[model samples]
Target: GRALSELDSGMNRVQAMRSYAGDQLNRADRLESDMKDQALTQEGARSRAEDIDMITALSQVETQKVGLQAALQSYAQMQKLSLFNYIG
Candidate 1:
């Protein structure tokens, strides 16, 4: 009878350990999912920031191109109005 009681106790201990291991496995899986979600969120934010920067850079380039064209036009007009033409 004593040996039977000891065997039962050992079985219960094994069952408890199995249950704990299963719970830990489930927790690990949840943590992995959360990490993946966080990484995706960060990547999305980075992509948006880069897109905004590119748009701003493109706008600045357009503005500079316009300014350069205006300056070139003014320079050409000045060249046409020479001192030699005015004096002679």
Candidate 2:
């Protein structure tokens, strides 16, 4: 009985670890998606920068900064929520 109980406990831990690893993988995928979006936005801005004047370039840079800030904030919030879920 003790051996069976120990085996059960080990199996539960393994299952929990699998769940945790899956969550980590999901988080990584989300971040990769976010990075792709940002990269596209940056690429577009770069393409425009070649033809645009200084003022437009500056404006686009500011827009990019705002977008980046929002993305970071959103990522932080998601991380916090996921952590809470995992812990609680």
Best model number under TM-score = 1
- Candidate 1 lDDT over 20-67, as tens digits, reads 999999999999999999999999999987778777888999999999
Kindly list the per-residue Cα lDDT of model 2 for residues 1-88, writing each as its tens digit. 9999999999999999999999999999999999999999999989886778998778999999999999999998887787669888
Give the clash total for candidate 2.
0
Error of 2 at 47 (Å): 0.9
lDDT of each: 0.96, 0.94
Provide the global lDDT of candidate 1 against the true structure.
0.96
User: Cα lDDT of model 2 overall?
Assistant: 0.94
TM-score of 1: 0.58
Q: Itemize residue pairs with steric clashes in candidate 2.
A: none
